[model samples]
Target: MRVLLVGAGGVGTAVTRIAARRSFLTHMVVADYDLARAEAAVAALGEQGTRFSARRLDASDQDAVRTALVDERCDVLLNATDPRFVMPLFEAALAAGTHYMDMAMSLSAPHATAPYEECGVKLGDEQFAQAAAWEASDRMALVGMGVEPGLSDVFARYAAEELFDEIEEIGVRDGANLTVEGYDFAPSFSIWTTIEECLNPPVVYEKDRGWFTTAPFSEPEVFEFPEGIGPVECVNVEHEEVLLIPRWVDARRVTFKYGLGDDFIAKLKTLHELGLDATAKVAVPGPDGPVQVSPRDVVAACLPDPATLGDRMTGKTCAGTWVKGTKDGSAREVYLYHVVDNEWSMREYGSQAVVWQTALNPVIALELMATGAWKGSGVLGPEALPPRPFLDLLGAYDSPWGLREER
Candidate 1:
């Protein structure tokens, strides 16, 4: 299948590496605003990049993106950009009549008055609003296809189908023991995304109460992660799985928590307090004159790119779903997880653990879509597809998942 990948950052770059090894991909056009970045990603593939090419494109330009989709005759528009560019790429795919997929969903806003108690525009609300449009076109828009929301969501459906007859709670728990050398405050993923999700009021779901907002980092608890990354304190973070899972999987309650340590939390709070996390553009003095720039963008510019930190990174990162329920009149509790060690990932794929893990799922999804193993129209999550085939494919990629009994 011919693909148009819209980002050439770390995750997007790792995607090209993984896709290059697969025979199912015919051609993948890696596009970015910085043409050099896209070219570099493709060039890194060396002899294996015969089927890959690079292009210069802006994700926010819907008409231009649509034109590019049509010009390149791409069957899918794979978005690897930030959440801020979700809608434009989504709409572009709709206009181009191509299947669409994204690692992250659209941005959400807090409730005007009851910011901590009520959700204003929840995650993926904007994409779900256009579900009918996609269905009418017989095209699919799969949002939240990254590791946490993607593989974690798949694990939720798998447990519901194969492990439990009745599920009480499905909580997505994410943690990492990875550390980067020479940097005291470096994130393993996108800092823009990390700030956005952590600062916003987190959302939780209940069968009776529906969805409600809570204070950021609320209801903290320590979760013991498998695969050598032991116990870490986790807290609620506004994540897409909390919004995506309940629609397809049967569960009384749903949540998503991240194991962001105390130092990371404190730094994030300080950014919020100083308004450095704001995405809105403000005037700043430049070499030419006063320039309009986003504070968050400036903050991102100040940090080392996460994609480049693999060589210095150590330890592992885990993404999993913790379920509690009853199966055949017996109580059941399990955590289905996928872990990636930085040293292994860097040696094998020349990419970091967190980014490589996130990149792996979408390529698998794309291959499945090409092979007809997974098929759907309209906006959907990973849970909406057949979980067995996806989990099986993970092993084929040499990144097998695991399950641990909690009780």
Candidate 2:
């Protein structure tokens, strides 16, 4: 199948690497606003064939995105770009009459202020506002198919279906316990996204009561993962699964947490306290008097690009769903986790685990979709589909995944 791959950032780069190796994806067009990066991504594959090609695309531009899809005759449009451009690319997909998939859900525009700043709203639902229209057209948009929200959501369903009878709560914990050698500060994924998700107030969902808000990094709890990542502080964050899972399963409490260490936490708080997260541009007195810049953008520009961290990054990132409830009248708790080593992942896919794990899932989901194993219309999260086949297919990658009984 011909696939239209957009954006060539770290995640996008990893997606390209994995897609190049997939036999089902015979043709791929790697498009990005930064044309050089797109071409570099294609070159990195080292494949000498017309199966892979590069093109320049302004995914945010409606006409550009639609033209690329239509011209390429892509069977599916895979959005590996920033969440901010999700709607435009999705609209383009619908306009091009192709199925679509995105690794993560959308974010309020980077420079958003006040209301949307809270990040406590149902971001996923709001992002794909045209779900009904997609449904009407019989096209599919798989949302939040990344590592944390994607696999964690599917693990929850697997627990509900195969492990638990009376489910009480499902908590998704993501820990990035890695070291980037020489860099003092580097994000494994999108720096813009990392800032936005952590800088805003977090959200949680409860049975009957519905959704409610919490402070960013509130209610810090330490969880010890199975692969000996040890106990790491996991603080609440506004993740899409917390909003999506409750719609399909009955649970009293659902939450998402990130293991951002004290240093990162302190630094983020400082950025917020200094108002560096603001999207609005301001004039700074420079050599020529007034120069305009967004403090947030300035901060992001100063940090190391996450894509460059693969070789230098060392350690593991463990993310999964921890389910606690009753099974056949016996109280039980099971942790379904995926652990990825930065070094190995970098060697194999030329991507760090954080990028490798998230980027790979959506490609696999597309494999299922193209092969007719996964069929659905409109927008959907991981739990909306059957978990068995997806997880079974995911096993082909041979990353470490297993269930642990903490009874």
Candidate 3:
């Protein structure tokens, strides 16, 4: 299978390394808006003797994406790009008759200055609308396939099928307890995406009340993680898992939280208060005169490149789903979790735990698709398919999930 990956950032780099090692992939194309980043990613791959080619791609342009898919004869289009570029890439993949996979849902409008509200907007809702279209064409697209949305959703499904007679709640929690030595502030993932998810109004769902909104960082609680990670404070945040899981599981409650530290929350609040999260073009006086740029872009550019933080990062990422329900008429709960060590991941995969966990799982999903171990047609999230086939393959990648039944 030929794969065309459409981003060369940290996640893209991790995915490329995994894909290059996959025996099924005949050739891989690493495309990015910046040719240098693409070349850099491929160069690192070359050092590892992983065969890959690089290309300059304007991911925002639909025509360019379609052209690249056709020219490369790509069987799978892995979108490691930001959510802003997701829709066009998916559309292009559909046009070129290629399977599509991405880490998050597309922004409803790429030009929106603020995140969409919960009343009517949702992650992957736009793609879900095209489910019939994809099914008709015998194509498939997986959205929000990263660690939290992807793995957490798979955990929820596994619990529903294996552990619980009736699932009451699916709580997805992500805690990245890693420290990058040189920086007081650095996002483990994309700066733009972190800001969007953190600053936006949080959404949570209850079976009795339906979808509702909360202030960013509401409903704070401390939970103990397994195997020495200890207790970390988590808060309700807007994430795709809440939206996607509800489509498959009829849970009474669905929510997501991230263990973003208080200091980081304060910094994000400052950025929000200063209007630095907006995507609107603003003219600021530059050394050469007036320069037009987006504030969020400026903020992201001024930060250290996320791709270089792997070696300096140390700690573990313990993210999982906490499911509460009854099994065989008795109350039971289980924590389906996966933990990754930052230093170990960096040593093994040249990526931090956060990026390594998020980027590598999609390849497992791809393997299932390639081997026909899993079959589906249409736009689907992780829960829309069988969990064991994907979860069973995790141990091979040095990332295995655990299940802890709590008293």
Candidate 4:
């Protein structure tokens, strides 16, 4: 399978490393706005880089992306760019008649008046709205194929199909104990996305209440993560899983929470209070004169790029789904999770734990598409496909998942 990978950041670079070892990918074109970054990612592979090449392509240029897809004869376009570019990349793939996949979905907005109580343009709403067009073209646009929304959604489907007759709730709980060597505060993933998901009003799904919005960091709970990570305080965060899972899986409630401890939550709150999290352009003094810049971009620029922190990072990160339900007239509760140790991921793939974990699932999904093990059309989430094939493939990649019973 030939692929046009649209980012050269941490996750995109990790994807190259993982896909390099796999035999399914015949060729991959690593494209990014920065030519040097894209070249560096492919060049790092050495002999394994033979099947891969680098190109400079702006993700926001729809015509250019479409032309690249056709010029390279890529069967799929894997978007590793930030959420802001999802629409353009997605439309380009559709226009080029190629399959598309993204770790994060399109951007969202809060409801005008009832921002807390209601949801306006929820996550994946823009992508799903074009489902009919994709269906008509007989092509697929897989959104939210990253670790949490991707693997967690698959776990929910697995539980509903094999472990439970009726599910009460499916909550995605993400936690990490990883830290950098010197930085007092360092986000393990893209801070642009981190701010977008963390500070936005969280969404929750209930069978009766449907999907509604709540205050940011609402519904705090202490979730005890397995594999020595222990218990961490998790809180509601706007994530793709909450919006994607319910459309296919039956559940009374669905939610996504991150194990953001007090310091992290407090910092995010401060960024909100100071308007540092806003993405709108503001005139700021540049080297020459006044310049328009996004406050969030300035914040991201000041922090260390998460991709370069693999060598300094340590510990582990967990992404999983916790399900509560009934099976054969008996109550059941289980957490099916995938954990990646920073030491192991850094040693093996030269990628940090968080991005490496996020990078693998989409490649696995692509391999499935290549081998014809998983097939679908229109806009779909990870849950819409068969889960068993995906779960079995994880072991082949040397990253096995575990299940803990909490009953």
What are the per-residue Cα lDDT tens digits for candidate 4 across 74-168? 99999999999999999999999999999999888999999999999999899999999999999989889989889999999999899999999
Question: What TM-scores do the predictions have?
Answer: 0.99, 0.94, 0.95, 0.99
lDDT of 3 by residue, 67-134 (tens): 99999988989999888898899999999989999988966322144433344466677888898999
Total backbone clashes of candidate 2, pairs 3 or more residues apart or in separate chains: 1
Off by over 4 Å in 2: 108-120, 284-291
Please report, as a residue range, the 10-residue window in candidate 4 with the lowest summed lDDT: 140-149
Off by over 4 Å in 4: none
Superposed by TM-score, candidate 3 places the C-alpha of residue 293 at a distance from the truth, in angstroms, of 0.9
Q: Per-residue lDDT for 24-48 in model 2, tens only? A: 7779899999999999988988854
lDDT of each: 0.96, 0.83, 0.86, 0.95
Error of 3 at 186 (Å): 1.6
Q: Judged by lDDT against the true structure, how good is candidate 3?
A: 0.86
Evaluate model 1: give its lDDT: 0.96
Question: How large an RMSD does model 3 have?
Answer: 2.3
Model 2 Cα shift for residue 391 (angstroms): 1.0
Could you tell me how far off, in angstroms, the CA of residue 231 lies in candidate 3 after the best superposition? 0.8
